[model samples]
Target: MSEKMQLVIDGDSVAFKQSAGFEFRLNLSEFPDLVKAHLAKVKPTANTKSTQACESLGAEVLEKDFEWEFLKPFIRDVCRWGGFALIYAKVLNEK
Candidate 1:
């Protein structure tokens, strides 16, 4: 649950120390930029028609790969995962 995550705030810095060493860190000065960036990336949940399209593919494709540089910052915001995501629905727009 999101409630269990550790939110570390010291002076002007903000760092979220999440489970499994996944953390999101940002300085107080970066608040405006962080808000702007992630807001631009935020998206609404997928519709039913699109969810069905994801059935054709599975998580097996990514199960064997590991990229720390990308994963490091990515894990903090990776919700819908119970610590790990071995399978996920690839939401797509209806054709």
Candidate 2:
């Protein structure tokens, strides 16, 4: 049997099963902090000043943008489908 987890965001509930070879857990309550950090890193445009600040903070502007773009579609698909099929598809495509 697979381990399952549930996450609730903004009153919407999502349940996910642990994917093969990837077993971990998340504390949903920390999601806000996670979002704050992600936003802080990715929200700014890639300017010389911003890039320097990001580098000093050990944050890579290009990398953050790339990661955000990569996850955006999956997030949209998950919200639209209300299931893990999109996630499975993404994982399958990566292999």
Best by lDDT: 1
Candidate 1 residue 66 Cα shift, in angstroms, is: 43
Q: Which ten-residue region of model 2 has the weakest summed lDDT?
A: 43-52
Tens digits of per-residue lDDT for model 1, 1-95:
45467999989999998678888888999998976775566443442212222222223224425354433323322423222333223321110
Residue-level lDDT of model 2, residues 1-95, one tens digit each, is 75655443334333344445443445667677987786577433322233234343333434566475555443444333333444655654563
Model 1 residue 2 CA deviation in Å: 9.3
Residue pairs in collision within model 1: none
RMSD (Cα, Å) for all candidates, in order, is: 15.4, 13.4
Taken over the whole model, the C-alpha lDDT of each candidate is: 0.48, 0.46
TM-score of each: 0.33, 0.28
